[model samples]
Target: MFSEWKFTAKEIAEKPDLFLSGHRACAGCAPATVLRLIMKAVRGPTIVTNATGCMEVVSSIYPYTSWAVPWIHTAFENAAANASGIESALKILKKKGKIKHEHVDVIALAGDGGTYDIGIQALSGAVERGHDFLYVLYDNEAYMNTGIQRSGGTPFGASTTTSPAGTVIPGKLQNKKPIADIMVAHEIPYVATASPFYWRDLITKARKGIEVDGPAFLHVFAPCPRGWRSDPAKSIELSRLAVETCIFPLWEAINGEYQLSTPSKVLALAPQKKKPVREYLKLQGRFRHLFTPKFEKLTEEIQRITDERWQRLLRKCGMT
Candidate 1:
């Protein structure tokens, strides 16, 4: 039904913005950009359930909304559950001839705090039940809506309010939870990682996720300027650097088969093509401490971890 939805860069540029302007997002909020891309990819009637996070708080502040489609604001831990219910209701309505549309895309949007921690169980249950919907995780790596508190998605050695870098310890001690892998383990029909820097790829993945027959998951890397203490204008640059550094590999799993996305495919095949993680980390204040003499070794550890993870992904994609 959505075959005609495929779009060229110029076409996408000319398309109407489903995520309208004049809302309260940060100056260079990548998550806000991700939302716009996702909405632009929709080719039919869609219902969006957004978790209580930055996007929700900013877009839907009482008496105002940025969404052009039907949108529901759900609790922090139940965006998936809400989308599941919406899908089920759509099915029932269609069966009863109450709704004219045969297919209405259902999308659940959440942040790292909601997806990796609070909403994981709900998301797991929804996908396990094989609901026909899409779950998009806009991971800024911390609870940026409330404060820069560390979440399960926070990378190792990254400082946050809850995991501050101090004399005794470096930033967050634990590595980022592999939420995409966890979704793949659920055996969903489609699972992918995206970044706002690659708008076409992100839009393609969003379309695929929505068009899939069963549940789909998208883990999008959204740079948080306020939380990461990075320059607002460099958000897109940081996103690109993340992919080049293999800090966030672009890849997708379709029906249990993994394949590296175009941007990261060359990096996987040619290890030397991958930039050093430091190139990506140095721009963000959250990782500034890692540059200090006392915490320099922690930076090396982070590099080791990133390389290992990239290698693991290459193997999974059968590129290594």
Candidate 2:
């Protein structure tokens, strides 16, 4: 619906740098880029709660932090809870005229491990209580900080330290959990799936989620070069290929009404128009085993799931 809004590289570059440079992300850190785009959406005062993960470790080293706004480093499982408390306190302070908080945006950030597994309970509670804040999860498909261990967000047939691709087993045996759908089931005001490759959509979604009165969730697709064993320069390219292949769709569920985002809307017209899953799989080392002739069955299995997911999303958005 918001196709007319356009942003240029220069415009985004000139925006106030809420996330400073000189952090410990890899050469092409997609999560850091996603953070930058999200922060650009709201230039005013912001209070951020970050969970223990790659972002918190890299951005806020002991002596310094890249964040220009008021930030809190909470435990891995309670960022959402802490954010809820902070937001509630802000409301009371604003009501009592104790703090001059006009446009302060409260945000909770976590990784896939923190969001899908460790922090799901706190997230559910915060949203159910009708907190006015945005919860964003940068999904890298595994626990990237400690090690490359499989997470609930990990897709099938991808190899992690725990879910290794060996002689007996191919890779992770289970499909990824549909966390976005789970959030939608909560009947929240807004929930969205975004990718760092589409900065405009990411920024717009973050701004809308912040403006909404109720809780909002944004699941961002951020590629991990070290974890995925992919080329550093191809991170953004892989993200785009992921969307064009329908492996990761760009969509939003707003107030229980589902619709594809700008880029996804254009491609949803014809599922056949999207690139094949092989184009997306071959680039990642984690899926390299599936490309071999011996693992044809595994590759086909992954393709089957991809087709099913793409069609399901289409039906959900009423594009079918």
Candidate 3:
């Protein structure tokens, strides 16, 4: 199906802006770019339900909004629930001949804090109910909108306000929650991981997710300049490095079957081609402490964890 999807630069340039400018996302904000790319993939009428997080706070300030489509700002724990209700209401309206459209896509957007933590229950319930909707989690890894607090999605050794690196502790003690794996466990029609750096892959996944008949989930990595203390200009670079290092392998699942995306597939087939995870860590200030002599082992531990995860993913894809 993805092979059938095609778009050219000119065609993309001609598409109307579904996510407009003039709101207040930070400069070089990858989540904002993620929203734009997702909107670019939309083919028909759509409604968006967004959880309260960085994107919501920045995109919908006061009387203004960046969304050109019908959008609702839901509480932190209810975006997916809201989307499920919207999909059901649309179905009812169509049955009653109150709505003319044959189909209207429902999309739910949330950050890591809202999705991996507060909103997991709602997301799980909606998917289990076989809701016809797409849930996109733009993961910046921390509660960026709430002052960079540590969250379930936060990686180990990443210092945050709550998980500060110090003498006794070296950051979050837990591994990043395997949210994508959890979504795949739901046995949804579609589940994918994406990054803004891979525009084509991201767009294709978004379109596929929206077109699926049942619940779909896309866990998108969105680099945060503020939260990660990385250079604004390096957002895309960080995104690329993340995949190259196997820190965030691009992959998808359909009907509980896993397949690595093209870029990650290459690395999986030739393990030596994968870059060391340190290249990704060195670019971000959150991992600065890991490079110190006192915490040197933490860096090695992070690399080992990344390698283990990548190998496990390869096994799932039947590449190992």
List the candidates' TM-scores in order. Answer: 0.98, 0.96, 0.98
Residue 262 displacement (Å), model 1: 0.7
Angstrom error of the Cα, residue 31, model 3: value is 0.3
What clash count goes with each model?
0, 0, 0
List candidate 1 segments past 4 Å from native. Answer: 1-5
**Could you give candidate 1's per-residue lDDT for residues 87-175 as a string of tens digits?**
99999999999999979999999999999999999999999999999999999999999999999999999999999999888899999
Clashing pairs for model 1 are: none
Per-residue accuracy of model 3 over 1-320 as CA lDDT, tens digit each: 33467998688768998999997999889999999999999989999999999899888997899999999985999999999899999999999999999999999999999999999999999999999988999999999998999999999999999999998799999999999999999888899999989988999999999988999999999999999999999999999999999999999998889999998998887878999989999999998898888898998899999989988998899987
The local lDDT score (0 to 100) that residue 315 gets in candidate 3 is: 89
Per-residue alpha-carbon lDDT of candidate 2 for residues 1-320, written as tens digits (9 for 90 to 100): 22344568798789888888988887888999999899988746889999999999999997989999889996999889989999989998998999986757899999999999999999999999999899999999999998899999999999999999887788899999999999999999999999988888899899888888889999999999999999999999988998998889999998989999978887887656788888899999999889777776887787889889989999999988
lDDT of residue 93 for candidate 2: 90
RMSD list, candidates in order: 1.2, 1.8, 1.1
Candidates 1 and 2, the one with greater lDDT? 1
Residue 161 accuracy (lDDT) in model 3: 95
Candidate 2, after superposition: displacement of residue 294 in Å? 2.8
**Whole-model Cα lDDT per candidate?**
0.93, 0.90, 0.93
RMSD of 1: 1.2
